[model samples]
Target: MLDYSVRTATTHTPEFLGLPQGAWVQEGGPQFAGQGVVVGLIDTGIDPTHPSFADDLSTDSYPVPAHYSGICEVTNDFPSGSCNRKLVGARHFAASAITRGVFNASQDLASPSDSDGHGTHTASIAAGNHGIPVVVAGHQFGNASGMAPRAHIAVYKALYKSFGGFAADVVAAIDQAAEDNVDIISLSITPNRRPPGLATFFNPIDMALLSAVKAGIFVVQAAGNTGPSPKSMSSYSPWIFTVGASAHDRVYNNYVVLGNNLTIQGVGLAPGTDGDSMYSLIAAPHALKNNTVSPTEMSLGECQDSSRLDADLIKGKILVCSYSIRFVLGLSSVKQALDTANNVSAAGVIFYLDPFVLGFQLNPTPMRMPGLIIPSSDDSKVFLTYYNDSLVRDETSGRIVRFDAVAKILGGLNPNYGNSAPKVMFYSARGPDPEDNSLSNADILKPNLIAPGSSIWGAWSSLGLDSAEFAGESFAMLSGTSMAAPHVAGLAALIKQKFPSFSPAAIASALSTTTTLSDRQGKPIMAQRTYSNPDSTQSPATAFDMGNGFVNATAALDPGIIFDCAQ
Candidate 1:
């Protein structure tokens, strides 16, 4: 999922970026399309009813694959018939947590239905149906399609809220995936910590992956998103195809125009502002009527209750809020500011990115009003300049400066960085080794491949209806390495469809060796820099950044010599 900041309508399909059907269709070559193959995903599970998972375009009935032994888990909320041919199998595992009295049945379902949206998104990316109209915040992002539209999906639920998944649960899911005899397994589960050794035989999850691989199932895992910091990759298992995330040629452009005639481009999921309108700008610190100093990032950034704002001064103006660099504000932060602005009937809100989190990382977020996230440590300067200039002057003053700020939608028609595809995502994990040098960085390179993972559009869970973009919708957008790993998995399924006799290692080799270092036009690809005093500098994406660079499915179909390795 490329962070969906709600901008632009891509003129191309998923295949245009060399996946789903782009490269192969353009080449007019093998029509694999992942037909008759299974893509097993171990995550939080999936929405059985998402159009992305339905073969008949509805949650009606479809025949299950003959080899699929996985069960369609039935709960009071989710029925058994939900697992159709597209979603051939579904299962849940939370035994350790339930036995340990740690699982909350009230919030966490004991069934296979996805309570969280992560699994559904990744699964859809791997092998969901194609030509599904993807609309986020009322803006259609063309038609959404997956890497392998015809691939069958087998879900293994293991993750829970807060602390991700218990190790036992994740490991058990992998074992079941093997038992179910799925062709490929996608593991984007966040590691509890960096593994102590190179070989994956020690950790329970890694051990499960090793067994799955030995059983001839291709495994794909995420290079954790704790990057810009080198040697911070969590998944280091050689057998598992660890994937890193990279930026594609899609950018969501949400911009802001100041009263001082300064038009600063930003990003967000602002769907309301139809056109530009003039308004006054009010700073959050200035709106503080009580003047109580905020100590926490949320309190300051969100303009929480304790910070009493002057409603009189705020009415009919755009609120500019600022916070420290320590934490990135969540959806709650966006809602809180909207609440404050709504009280005064303010036009909109602009969140000044206080250092730490880079600007381009601001994805489109659903908002009550036209809200834009400005990625700048000094955006406050713009507000202050406007405010001061707008102040009424005395008799001695020659000319008066006016602060008439304006906000525009800059919606999903033209993204700012539309052509800057394949840049390593800001948060995509980077690595030459899995851990720091003190713990001994392994000689083995991780993140075997990169794919369309950031701000990706996919199916969402209705039960998890907390987002404004997904109030009653079937599909939404998100970003993470979790979104990246399944892409390779889908490709693996296609390779299997073409070369059924090829081993998992052989499939992995085809995908890995057949990757491209340059973009479609042969431009050198740029990688995101994780470690620096100035953290935004993008370097050349190497094998550490992108395993073999972006996955090239068309070329991979005929890599004459299989590049087998010793793992």
Candidate 2:
């Protein structure tokens, strides 16, 4: 379910999150506006005819066809076509099945379109158009502007539609990018699962990444959005730049309600008929029940419905939950619950936990509502309580009482802060180099830097656009290190534009030096703030979390100091 019509814009129009839309271009755009530096975006393919990029050059249809000179054979077997709305190119690769072992693995790449919208968004953020007016929420904002607005793109459809593919294809793509002499290689895809005992085998993709680095191509990868845990690191190879997510200055008010028995202390008293309250009890994501295989859609009505604690089900509700649902579902669930309460209803929803899901928060939207989203970890206890209750309930009771709950604001959660602004998101993965540590499998000296990754909006596929019923009027706002990695990649292109002789190591060093060790909120990240002792508050530094500091694009472009790999 990808939405293609939601075009990413370039102005800080406050419609979304008031992010620095044209910040990269404020000073007459990047130094490499059109120097013909080829940047290879290795992810899902791109939609060249996107209004923001329709006129820009694409490697897909360049009359002067480029070479894909790599150790792995390259071919243009993927077809290219343009619809009245978009220009799409397709490609495929094979995947290795873990359960069946390597010998049984087969080629799995299929015609690639962004069946999932992650790749398209990543590409746009790295090299989108410089000036095109984008309309969102009835306001006309500028176009799909990237850090390197004028760089030419060589898109590799390495990640398949279902996000199923082998790591070998990724390695092949990297080799091709290097042979093609791409200025920067942006990788937004990571392994979906860390196979048992697989790290013992030499990963061809890791080797390819190393090769690309040696060839002087700057590699930028997503740090992953799994959060404060030690097992959330996405990519830990020292050869590439890893990125994190941060909250924007803008606030999109949404709400969630607490369960009847579970009382959140800080929030104000129950609602009154006088009017809406303003304080927020907790600055967190509210939990929701989800079926592992089912997709959940949230609406305002749902949020209102969840607030009715008096409903019969509240007494025995079992909350089945998952974090995979879209942010919209969380917001709507909260709003619906509140409305139900206003009407003096008593139904409660129970949330049950499904394994391996991530939770999210709501950003400020133009239409204001009081809501909050809870992290999956925080809601697990509540869910387990009701789940256990259901298992032991007497046969006389009817279907397990299920009441959905969403949190709403009462006050206290302000959006303003000093340099510690909400720019750096807490959920961004951390790392300590798993390869060097037995608990994790990541390389110790990798993911040297961080970049801008949060609620990044971008282009959508024609197929995706048609499937989305709501949020259909404009661009999609997605958050992840995937979005942030490209910003750094584009910056690398700009550096190459200025200092053509600089090697990839120099570029990585420059970026790392220029970045702030702390996040936008001024919180010390990386090795600086890990729990290292056994004081109940301290733990070991695990490579699976906190790779490096956040990236400083402005500083990387003109670093005061640089690391010389030659030494």
Q: lDDT per prediction? A: 0.69, 0.47
Candidate number achieving the greatest TM-score relative to the actual structure: 1
| Candidate 2 error regions (>4 Å) | 1-34, 56-112, 136-144, 195-201, 254-419, 422-424, 438-446, 465-474, 518-548
lDDT value for candidate 2?
0.47
Instruction: Report the poorest 10 consecutive residues by lDDT, candidate 1.
Output: 1-10
Clashes of 1: 25
Kindly list the per-residue Cα lDDT of model 2 for residues 1-567, writing each as its tens digit.
110110111232122221233324333444334245566777766554456445434443322124332222223323334311112222333333232243211232244444445565666777666555645434443455666666666766565443344666666667767777777888876666454454622355556788878877777777665555554566766666776554444332222334344533221112211133222121011222331121234332133334322333222221222323532433333323434433432222222222233333433232112222333444556644533443322357432233233332332233223343333445566665444554445446444654555545566554343213213333455666677678777777777766778888888778767655654455654232222211223222222333345555555556777776851
lDDT of 2 at 459: 61
lDDT of 1 by residue, 247-273 (tens): 667666766766556777666766535
Residue 13 in model 1: lDDT? 27
